[model samples]
Target: MDPFIEINAIRKGLADGEYSSAEITKFYLDRAKKLNSQLNSFISFCEEQAIEQAKNADNKIAEGSSGPITGIPLAHKDIFCTKGITTTCGSRMLENFVAPYDATVVERLNKAGAVTIGKANMDEFAMGSSNENSYFGNTSNPWDTDRVPGGSSGGSAAAVAAGMIPIATGTDTGGSIRQPAAFCGISGLKPTYGRVSRYGMIAFASSLDQAGVLGRSVADICLLLSQFGGPDVLDSTSHPIPDNWLSSNPKLNPTKPEAKITIGLPREYFDQTPNLKSVEIAMRVFENAGCILKEVSLPSTESAIPAYYIIAGAEASTNLSRYDGVRFGYRCQDPESLSDLYQRSRNEGFGKEVKRRILTGTYALSVGYYDAYYLKAQKIRRLIQQDFLEVFNKVDLILCPTSPGVAFKKGALSENPVEMYKQDIFTIPSSLAGLPAMSIPCGFQNNLPIGMQLIAPHFAERKLIEWGHYFQSLTDWHKKVPELS
Candidate 1:
């Protein structure tokens, strides 16, 4: 079997009995084993457990009880808690940690009989725009080992692109999922806020963090969303399942071909980003797709990175307070006093980046600075969301380059944190607006990949995927695999 085939193709093979679930699992396992040393895509592999699950899937097939995801091979980001498996969130603080329960997404995928190959690496506590913050190691882009895959979900994207897994789950806060998928030349969607339950997933910024799916094509992404999206009674923020994503989305179904899809080109995103060749490629791809392009203005869009940093970092500071060396995570070897233990444990356990954000967040949300910085940033967030809402009223979907350019060489942006934050300028608005958005590979730039982003209104993931599917049908960008082929 060609390991890079999308999820739906594997399903077709399974339906015809051409490949058993176990065989499919082994295919991905062998691929992962071969490439993991070079790519460092996976933080941990559940090889034995994956085979067991595959066997159970085969048993279900034998019993004539099949589900949409039965026998499929998928992976989870290290951030998503998997029962009895390590859920490190790519931070050294929890490097030895294992979750007692599976995250809602993991549980759902397991119940549907999907085999989890392993936990993909990510930015430490989902912090950086690239995968370099990882405590385990940096994830190398499969396309060019010297270049970085996007982060903090870079591992998930690189794994799918390298044919190590059919699909993987990712969490987007800012541009984590979309940007990385763009860099790796895969398809990834950041569903509307509250679209997927957050239960058991490590929190970075509760309001901004969203769990999403990454795959080789739009169809595979849609299939995963249909099964995992919707309200979970366990999560208070979750909403009722939106209408059937695939059937109702006109872009996915061309029954109404006359319906012209409008694509918004945000001038601010292009103007502020460093690269234009990649952006030009994306614009050409959208124009080729028969999309009507219009210049849309979102004046406050430029401030997104600053506002997002304040908000996400502040939330992360609060959310991560529980890891104060007292609980189940890494602790100091010996301590003379309680305060000494608290300081020493965290000082030893946390990586430099996580600690930096913690200090920044804690200070920003501090008593005297709360109203000045944190509260003001929240107001700015409202303005950002309003800008998106107003723009969506003018266009069916907003199109932009997912990142300024293709993957950068490792250590390229390591020293300049501010420069790294700028890479997300095009992607942070949707996260701020709680909208449905996706990154689809449009073409290649200097052998690396460039992703064109599609953004839809809240609960309109169907629309985003529809346009994505239409675009994929026309172009072969998503079909391109890494040299690992």
Candidate 2:
């Protein structure tokens, strides 16, 4: 089996008998074991279970009952609860917790015949912009080990980037999926908030968190979405779709030469970014892609950062309060009483960034300050959504750099929290709006990958995927693998 085979190619190989699912699974398992120490991409590896699942897929293949992803190997971010597997959520609080049932994303993918080989690492409680905040350890960029893989889906992105896995599951709350995809030079999509099921996935911010995919190309995301894109009764947040939802999307015809689409470039991104060299280079790829590029404005974009933090923090505080010492997570030693237990357990369990956000959120949600901070932020969030809604009406999709600049040195932004927050300026507004956004490798700058982001209107992932696939067809940016030694 070719180690760098794309996910779709792997599926084709399985059907054509070129390679068995077991062989492919073993190849990835070996690579994950070999490079995990270097990249710290996986919190736990499930070699035995994955092999069994692969064997099952082979039986299904032999019986001619296999589906699109029936035999593919994938990694799930540790935030999704995997039955009988330790789901740490990259935090010490849940370090010892093993979920009794599978998350909806895990269950749906498993039913689609995909094999999960391991649990990818992430930022602690999905709080940080960098994977350095993980209790396990930071996941390093496969392109350059000294540089950080953007979080909290960094491990998933790193694994896919290194050819250790052809595809992986990720959760996006803010820029977790897209930012890391940009950093690692892979393709990732943060689908609309409720398009995919959230049941069984650990909650961060209920309104902001959404499960998505990261892969070697846009085509992989399309395939995965077809398999798992519908509703789940277990997850009330998942939208109910018509029975023919799969066939309802307009087919993407990338081969047509005269197929020109309108792409909007937000003035806020161009005006606010400190450096735009890499972004400028990436937009050139868009120019020659038969797009009618037009300048647009999302006036509330600057307020997205502050608004996102307030809402995310408030929701996180509420969701995370369940991790009291009485629950099934880490409890502090020698607690004198209930108060001591709650205080010490949280104090001892959480990382610095997680603690900081919790405090900020607690204050924002407090009685006197709730109307001033949380309420106002929600209003600003509505304004941000309105800005996107208005611009999207005029353009088929929006394009911009996934990050303000290329990947920075590890630990550089650790001391400057505000600068670290700004790292998400380009990616957060879409998240706030519950829109579908994608990150594809656009070019390289200073030896690091530059990611171009494509955002579509709510439930318009088909458009984003169509544009992404068409863009990837015209350029080899998505095909450039990091030369990790």
Candidate 3:
């Protein structure tokens, strides 16, 4: 069995009886178990449950009732609740927590017959950029084990890159999905905000958190999205699925787009270091495809980092208040009073980075500082959104580097929090605007992968897929994989 087999090929093989779902499931399960020690990509394995699901999928295939994703193996980020599976969210607070109900993303995928192999490790409470904040330990990049796999979706990206699974579910509160995908050399999508249901997924920053996928290619992501992307009654924020979003054949090759398609290059994003030269070289593919490239301005780009941190921190503080040790999560032993219990439990259970954000958030939302900080940040958020909306009026899509540079060493930015936050400078603006964005491997830098980002207008995911698929067809970047021993 080929570890890098495409999702469509897997589907065809299962339908033709070339192989059984049980066989493929076991193959990936064994591969994951073998590599997890070196990479630390998964927190827990669902071996027995995965095998059982594979058998059930085989039964469905025999009955001719299998769906598109039926029998396909996938891993879920630990932030999502999986019934009977431990959902640690990469924090000690939920280390022993087992969800009683499946997250909407998990439920939808299960109904499509995809088997859950395990829960991928992530930054504690989805807080870090380098995956070092994970309570379970950092996830190593498959390309270079000494380096970091970008976080908070680092495990998902690394696992997919190493071919442990064809695809995995990820959430992007800021650049969580795209950054890791770029660092690990895979395709990742952060859909338009509210495009996918978030119910039962642990909250990071409510308004900014969006569920997406990391995969080997855009086609694979489209196949999975067709199954799970849609409005859900449980999540009020979920958007209605566009009528034409899912076509009959999800893997159909996209036709050449009309010549009038225009992509914007924000001057602010382009004024960076030499590593972005790879992204500039990649722009020619679009030119050769007859698409127009226009230089545009997004002046608010400088303010994005500060604004994003403030907004995300404020929301994280409010959302995390539930884990006070008085309720369901980690509780301190033998507390004399409720206050002591709350203080000790949180101080001991939460990680350094998570505690930092909580403290910053609390201060921002405090009585004397609400308007001085949080309110001002919200006003800046509006400006950032307006900047994207203005640029969209002049172009159909925006192009930029996904990160300032390629993946760095594990401890490189751990001590310098400000420098670490700048790693997301390119990805943050699009996220703040609630637009659909994707990261695809474009070229290699110093033996590491370089990723270019594509941003489309709200709900314009199909456009991104079309352009991204076309780019992959021209370049072998996405096809290149690390030679893991």
Candidate 4:
């Protein structure tokens, strides 16, 4: 088996009997254990469970029964609950919490035959932009050990980049998927809100919390989407996407005249984010591909940060209230009173960042401030959506830098919380509007990867995927992997 082979090769190799599913599964598991000490990506390794599933997959393949990614090994962000497995969500609150059931995303993928490698580490309750918030410890970037691998989904991206796994699950609420994908130099797709089910995924901000895929390329993402997308009765937010949606979508072959589409370059992004040489090279790649770049302005971009914080914090405040020691989660040693238990458990379980957001959200949703904060932020979110809707009228997609700059040193923004929030300045607007967006490796700066974002209208993931596939087909940016030693 080829060590660097991605999703497509793994599937084909399995079908052709080049190697048994057990062989491939063991290969990844071995590598994950060997490299995890350096990257700290996986909080839990399901080696025995994975090999058992792989054995089942081998039997199925012998009988000629398999799905697209049958026998393919992947990882899930810690936020997704796995049955009988500890769904830590990167916090001590749930460090010992064993879920009774799998998340909807996990269940569907399991039925499709994708083997689980382990539970990837993430920010506590998926709250922080950097994986530094994980109670288990920080996940480092594969490119540079001292630097961050982006956040919330950093463990997923770092693992994939270092060749520990071919694909991983990610949740994007305010740029978690795309930003980390950029930082790790992999491909990540954050589908429009409700495009994928959120049941049992351990909610952060329910309204903005949507699961996505982080992997080698757009083709890999499309294959996963074909399997897991569409309606799930378990989640009311999981809307009905057409069956076999990828094949049904318009072809994005750039060579054809019909494939010609206008791409929008947001002027707001240029002035605010890091205008590095990599950004210039990325723009040139699009221009050289015959894409007509037109200047587009999302005037409301300036307000995305404040609005996203208010709204996300408010929702997070409500969702996290469930962990107050009474039900399951962590319980204090001895509780004299119920209030004491709640106070002690929460303070001990949650990290600094999680506590900060909870406080912010609680205040925003508090009486006399609800309308002034949460309600107003929701209105701002609408304006952000309208900005994209109007821009899409003239352009097929919007493209910009995934992050303001390349991956920063792990402790760079740790001191100043506000500085860390700026990492998602370019990504938050798209999340605010619940649009389909993706990040693909574009260039490198100071030995770190830089990512460019492609965003489409709500549920327009096909177009976003098309452009990502086309770009990756012609460029080797996504193919370049970090040299892990």
- As a whole number from 0 to 100, the lDDT of residue 105 in candidate 3 is 95
User: Which candidate tops TM-score?
Assistant: 3
State candidate 2's TM-score: 0.97
Which lDDT value does model 1 have at 10?
Answer: 86
Per-prediction TM-score, please? 0.96, 0.97, 0.98, 0.97
Worst 10-residue lDDT window for candidate 4 reads 249-258
Q: Which stretches of candidate 1 lie over 4 Å from their true place?
A: 246-258, 273-290
Q: Encode model 4's per-residue lDDT on 180-256: one tens digit a residue.
A: 99999999999989888899899999889899999988778878776777778899888775445553433345443
**Best-to-worst lDDT order:** 3, 4, 2, 1
Q: After superposition, how far is residue 73 of candidate 4 from its true place, in Å?
A: 0.3
Q: After aligning candidate 3 to the native by TM-score, how far in Å is the CA of 363 from where it should be?
A: 0.8
Candidates ranked, most accurate by TM-score first: 3, 4, 2, 1
lDDT of 1 at 2: 91
Candidate 3 stretches greater than 4 Å from native: 241-243, 247-249
Supply the global lDDT for candidate 2: 0.88
Off by over 4 Å in 4: 247-258
Better of 2 and 3 by TM-score: 3
The CA lDDT at 194 in model 2 is 90
Q: Which residue pairs in model 4 clash with each other?
A: none
> Which is the better candidate, 1 or 2, if ranked by lDDT?
2
**Per-residue lDDT of 1-485 in model 3, one digit per residue for the tens?**
88988899999999999999999999999999999999999999999999999999999999999999999999999999999999999999998999999999999899989999999999999998899999999999999999999999999999999999999999998899999999999999999998899999999899999999999999999899888888899999998665265534355575674556999999999987566777887898898788899999999999999999999999999999899987688999999998999999999999998888888899999999999899999999999999999999999999999999999999999998889998999888888899999999998987899999999999988889889998888888999888898
